[model samples]
Target chain A: MGLKRNVGLMEALRYQGKGPMLTYILHRIGGLSIVIFVGLHILAGYLANHAWGANLGIFINSIYENWLFQVFIFFFALFHAINGLRIVILDLWPKLIEYQREAIWLEWFVFLPIYGIALFVIVRSGLGG
Target chain B: MKTKQRPAPLGGFNFDYIMWLFTRLSALAMYLIVIVALTGALLMSARQNMSIADLMRWAFMPNPNHVASTNIPDIEVWKTIFWQVMAILMLFFAGAHGLHGLLNVVEDYISSRRIRMSLRALVLVIWVAISLIGITVIVTS
Candidate 1:
């Protein structure tokens, strides 16, 4: 918290760069991905008896085991948690809009790592030994 | 830089500017961590003799470095990290939207004070239970 962020033109541009717009943009999209995928996920959970307990269940099973699936879940996890926190912050501190920069730093520094560690643990164990 | 429309300043920094910075920084971080992790995974497996699906079995495993049973620490650490993260995300996503939606439903129809409290409690209980199950699934392997 006290490393001194003497942001130069390049470094400043790096922090205030073009990349995060996509991040925020995609974070919302990731929310949509989970919502869409999870719908099938829930349906599969319920339809476990149908398709000889196949079809949707199989799709769901095949997915979490997949590496891509893990990564997909990770991003969704990152954005969803971070964005959720954003909503929480909005509710709690509607007047602090001016400190959005600091808030974002806190979010990324705090939230994303929380997400990565959380998801890494969840996927690893839940998927199995 | 003053204008007639300029409003009160809370702390020298403008809220809009801060949000912009947040979106930028968060986005960059997301790209490096999530996006790069994903691409790295795909590229690493591309050279494997087996198909992509076969390779995933190990990478997503607790220890990507190990071919056999990953160490207990791998399972313990990674799973703990993974589930806790998922739970947070799920809570935010499911809790925020679902609970909010449920609240709206109650507000619109179930306008009784006692009944509303009861309904809200029920929703909280359900979400909590689900979250617990999710935790169990993540933890127990």
Candidate 2:
């Protein structure tokens, strides 16, 4: 049987899957973001080591050093890590699946303070404070 | 009475199952590596002289070259084969985990078997290229 394809992107976005849905979407986004960042990071390191590509490498590194980009990357990295741990825990102990929502709440509780501090530091450095 | 569980189809050796296990294990491995790198940096007094960018680079890969631009007076300690191994480990683990995750995402959107296989091949190529470049840099530097 063929799957139905009536739902569009806008419709899917409007579907409020609440906490589980939000976390699921964010996890995917976070994974993809980290992948992109790591790829570029390795490429930049490779380029920076060579004399011919040194300038290009420096330019890419400068982008990474930008406070705004740092903030975004850090947020995703932190969230992904925390949420991923939650998943592992839940998977290992299936009984905890009943409290998955509470687990996500705990994930945020663990995530926010660390992310807040990192954000503050990034901004402070960016402002030369 | 104990019930006997039937063996799983495909003897539970499916690609999806293997990748799922890999994703979980690799994530934990990366976390351990990062923690080790961070602790090493702290022991070396990274906070006293290293810029955040340099510190971050070292934390992620532990390659001595990443911290070459920092104000650390002696880098000889960081220039060890141990760190080269660490960098290569981080490269392979992160590359494999991240690319596999990407393939999972693509599979979610693309339903065609041919397209999925093609994308898998592409991701594999990209992963190999990244791994080669990363190892070359780590070993040479």
Candidate 3:
């Protein structure tokens, strides 16, 4: 508590802005989504491995060979991507001492374009008609 | 009595407790997935022979018939278990980079919205890529 009194206006604002708070929340969401994704990943790979005496691997390789699934893959991937970048940005910046809260909000702004480009490229390739 | 040693940077009892809890929860979910799948395979083991289509259909669309006439419970188990193990493994890659960044942020010495956004975006890419590959593997398989 004693250390807090010396905090400047910006420091105080940043603290109130909840960088740590948001991180904690995002961490949980990211963690859960990852788990869902992981579960699916293993099942797919196991099947693809042609395990249980089948060549399911071949089917998986060509999954994006269709349109709908390719799009499904795109959005799931995009959500995870945008959220992930936010977590990273929150951590790497050394200026959390002052503009940290501002930075947290800024994450949303930066995320949009990146998400769009990534989605476009992935969709085009995955759905390459 | 011996003096208490200094706590490790993040090694308090509370931290250890949480880690244990997380491991146990994750482990339990995984164990159940495997057990169910195996039991289903057991019923199918009798008239033994499988193919890629057999595996694909089994994984994506769970049913007693898909498992080669296995019991419904077994196929049901396989339904959720399918693809999870692979995703967990993929997580190892991101875990190395993402978790480290998370901790670094926690211990940040500076705070800037622009910088936060930048790093967040980077990790977002990682998250997206990993998941994309994961989905591609699961639904397609």
- For each of the candidates, the C-alpha root-mean-square deviation to the true structure, in angstroms, is 15.0, 6.2, 16.9
Which predicted model would earn the best TM-score?
2
Candidate 1, residue B129: Cα displacement in angstroms equals: 21
What lDDT does the true structure give each of the candidates? 0.50, 0.86, 0.47
Task: Note the DockQ of each predicted structure.
Answer: 0.05, 0.33, 0.03
Residues A1-129 of candidate 1: C-alpha lDDT, one tens digit per residue? 222323345654466444346556566567656545544554454444456766767677567657657667666755665765664565456797677767666767876676677566656666684
Q: Write the per-residue lDDT of candidate 2 for residues B18-128, one digit (tens) a residue.
A: 888898888889889999998898788798989776787788889887788898989987888888888889988999999999998876676566787899899999999
TM-score of each: 0.39, 0.89, 0.34
True contacts kept of 1: 0.00
Give the per-residue lDDT of model 3 (tens digit) for B32-135: 44345444444554225554335433433233334544433334444454445533443444443444344345334234446656776765665666556545
Please list the residue runs of candidate 3 whose C-alpha ends up more than 4 Å from where it truly belongs after superposition: A1-30, A51-98, A125-129, B1-141
Candidates in descending DockQ order: 2, 1, 3
TM-score of 3: 0.34
Predicted chain A of model 3: TM-score relative to the true chain A?
0.46
Better of 1 and 2 by lDDT: 2
Candidate 1 lDDT (Cα, 0 to 1): 0.50
